[model samples]
Target: MKKKLAATAIGAAMVLSMGTGVLAGANLQEIKAYLNGSITVKYNGSPVQLQDEQGAVVLPITYDGNTYLPVRSIAKTLNVAVNYDGATNTVLLGEQAEGVALAKDFKNSSYHTKDPNLTTYGGKDYKEVYFDNAKSSRSSSFMLYPKGKYQKLVLQVAATGNDIESFYVQDSKKDIKLKTTTIAIQDGLKTIEVDIAGVEELFVHADIKEDGGMFVPLTTSYFK
Candidate 1:
């Protein structure tokens, strides 16, 4: 991404004190901030191009040994909605929806696929899921922090090359198992839905009977 100077230095101040502290009152003030063109932002191993409202390239600002970037630009780039509430001085990123999140969208996952490729089954496009860890343990899992906002969980598991025994959902925070379902390749793809209302930390795991390149392909995983 190209690095260009902001239209004014206050641009940095606006971002530096967005929701809390100085800028919450929306009073005009002058503050010294430095524009460091050398700083580069990479999201998920890919370089991000930061820009401003007028399509001008924007660089990160350094203030009191802290660096700040344009949140609107970055969030929108990642396909997340961004909104500014001037009355409350609040910045909202993303919206509430029945489909709260996708499996590939979660960053706090363990022993699971990182870069999922588009795979098709049953005339539907699905993201292929594979275990990063070996098959000896016969399981892989991901962590989700819903913070009691969502009420439902839905996901599909399919076996492309081998049979999957089961997958389960759990509230890791409270050490409670929500639900579990068995997956049989002969039965085709299986959809597992569970009630997750008031769940804080959700744990989803898949148990495979055998290991293969396409052992457990998750067609869809989302929370409602």
Candidate 2:
């Protein structure tokens, strides 16, 4: 009978980022560890394949009587986001870390209009704005790919005229609506946050009154 080493997933919920380093002046203990290539990982009855950021297979390591696996790979498999603060040598799990600016990461494009215009309001310039023609009640949408790296989407929205109707957040890959809300132009600017856990692709949709107006959704921040 071959003795197989089993690795216990320690701190799988708190994963270390690829760039985070160990604490300073930490004592290092050297031990003889074995690399186990023939290990299977499973979740709920489903098998989980472990791979690095580059899609390379990562093996489990067995030291003494315990087995260890890569933290980032395990976190991703569990549908959790991992962030590291290099300045403080901290590992943040889920949405505990700071938010990421969406504009720097996501691509902007028009969904219904022939051309989307960039507008400014309250002394702040917005790059993604929805322009509606008064021909009919219409909607515009844009997409962002989170790939399970973010947990929430935070933004503020407002309409120039009385054409504000509704806002929706949908899981584009699953074709499911996660959240939706109606907006009133009299409310001025409205702030909203949507849960986006484990979502591969997300769609933000805005419904207008077709009264020839402008709708602006600002602040592209996401929690990781």
Best by TM-score: 2
Clashing pairs in 2: 7-67
Model 2 weakest 10-residue run by lDDT: 11-20
For every model shown, the clashing-pair count is 0, 1
Residue lDDT tens for model 1, 180-201: 7766768676677777655668
TM-score of 2: 0.65
CA lDDT scores, all candidates in order: 0.59, 0.62
The reply for model 2, stretches above 4 Å from the true place, is 1-32, 37-47, 51-57, 83-92, 110-118, 122-136, 163-166, 212-214, 220-224
Best by the lDDT measure: 2
Stretches off by above 4 angstroms in model 1 are: 1-97, 108-124, 127-137, 212-219
**What's the TM-score of every candidate structure?**
0.47, 0.65
TM-score, predicted candidate 1 vs. hidden true structure: 0.47
